[model samples]
Target chain A: MSGYIEAGYISVFSVLTLYGGSLIIRVRKTEKKLPDLTEEKKD
Target chain B: MSEVNFAAIPQVFSKRAETATKIIGVLALLSLIATVWLGLFVTPPDQFMGNLVRLLYVHPPIAWVMFVAYGVAFLSTLLYLWPRTRDLRFDRLAGASSEVGVIFTGLTLLSGSIWGRPTWGTWWTWDPLLTTTALLFVMYLGYLALRRLPGDPETRAKRSAIGGLVAFIDVPIVYFSVLWWKSLHQAPTVLDPVTGKTYIHGSMAYTLLLGFVAFTLLYVYFVAKRYRLERLKYLYDRVLLDEAIQERKREAADFKAYGADKKSLVPTAFAENGPALGDARFFGTEEESVVGGGEAGR
Candidate 1:
């Protein structure tokens, strides 16, 4: 019973953390691209 | 000297929204940690399903969040399809929501399967709830594929928008699936549609509510990030296109100007003889002259 409960918690945490981490990575990548995107378009 | 306007494009997301989402994200993480601790250690296990019922803290909220994501995608697609309000921003939003929705939906399916294995004595069954969920997943998988299909931006957006709208039909069907048909799956856990009440009580209810809040905040954060990514890519594409168009215009202008100044057009050559019997005059003003070889100086 305890094993099943622990497994469920682990699964939920893994999914949430991975999804949140991906979002953070993408936001940073896009931020870096912003200035270059503006400069290139203007050029 | 060619002006190809790139001024119409808008930022996919504002800096303020990004910062706000980051704050919400931090709060959401704390909320999730607290909720998990409450459900796992504080709350008592169910008398019927034992500790297996702890899975409830996570699964139902995932279903709710998945619905919200798909709903956002559907509404964005609808806005994009309407002529008066049509814009690429809506299409980008639709794409962002679909991406996040697909991941959450997949998680929901997995969580349900794990829960079922212990409670229902099987990992999966062709129950109404399970069948409909599987169908929804496949349909959105097709929708995401359409987004990446090879086409002009307008064509791709139209296809993906239409695909998203079509796939959204499965959402309502999934929601009503358990009610409209017989199934092993239980009815709504929280917010009973008939009695207008919650099925869970006390500490259980608090944990469930926490799950919903955390999942929703995560969804919003991901959607904003993904939308900005799409917008930056869109802007980069427009820049490349404008640069290419300007280069072509410059080449054409230079050719026309050089031809006029040097008397380099061989207009009489075409009438005197056809292409087969043509002299150097056909390609240039005279023998060995270059027709489109740019201004004569480097």
Candidate 2:
């Protein structure tokens, strides 16, 4: 309700969302560079 | 002699595991949103702390996950150290958990500081609990840095495990700092240490319980994603190294064939640039040479 409460909630949500977004991006980028490991194993 | 078996390294999650991780991620997001809505609009303001007490739902749950993350890292470190169960998977898990722990620990400090600004009349303090927690954050950060240091896989894992063990010593101390010393920080709210009784009741209690579950699920989801990313990065590095080694071997074979046709005593490159190429160690079989080359490159 107050400024401090707003700050705390916003900070938690922003940090978490940013961190989660970065993880997804990094995983996608790395996956693109890599051949499918299961398919490679089959070969 | 302790060569990494890249073939043995898990490169991707099974389809079922991937699907399960996705489900957990979605559940984490949904529950977290619910916790936020309930904490902000639904729960009644505290009798003493007033509306400021809203911060409690997020702060304590984040702190709890910090402890859980570090505890997992410590357990994984111990498993990595045990000879009977030594595995790089445990090492990767430990790294992933510690990284996530660092993020949660950081949020705990930030949220606590925000609350303290109004409650304690200051943004920060040197109180025992606060100091020990800050120390815990820094130490795990050091452990993460140590993991990035260049070395062979086994050496890196062993040293990182040792670093993790050392960093984790601060976790218990951080938890008990409020109890161990006179401090501005309040005692545990959910579960009192002395009487072993919960302080909050009714919807407040349920909301807090939901906060914990939501954050815990989020922590699990983050760690799973991080572990998969770590595996992918390692596999990518190994693939590049294997390619480099294969190229080197091909060059060596071509040079040797050329030298044989010319009836030369030594290849000109080996003669001019020292015996780097001619050395038996350089031409050793892939298994023998990979570890040495990998360590050098790392």
How many angstroms is residue B121 displaced in model 2 relative to the true structure, after the best TM-score fit? 0.9
lDDT of 1 by residue, B201-242 (tens): 888888888888987887887887788778877876776677
User: Could you say which candidate leads in DockQ?
Assistant: 2
Where does candidate 1 chain B have its weakest 10-residue lDDT segment? B289-298
* Per-model chain A TM: 0.74, 0.78
Tell me the DockQ of each model, to 2 decimals: 0.38, 0.53
* iRMSD, model 2, in Å: 4.6
lDDT string for model 2 (B247-269, tens) is 79999999888778653665666
* Real contacts recovered, all predictions: 0.46, 0.74
Best by lDDT: 2
Candidate 1 CAPRI classification by DockQ: acceptable
- Tell me the fnat of candidate 2: 0.74
Clash pairs (backbone) in predicted model 2: none
Question: Which sections of candidate 1 miss by over 4 Å?
Answer: A34-43, B1-13, B257-298
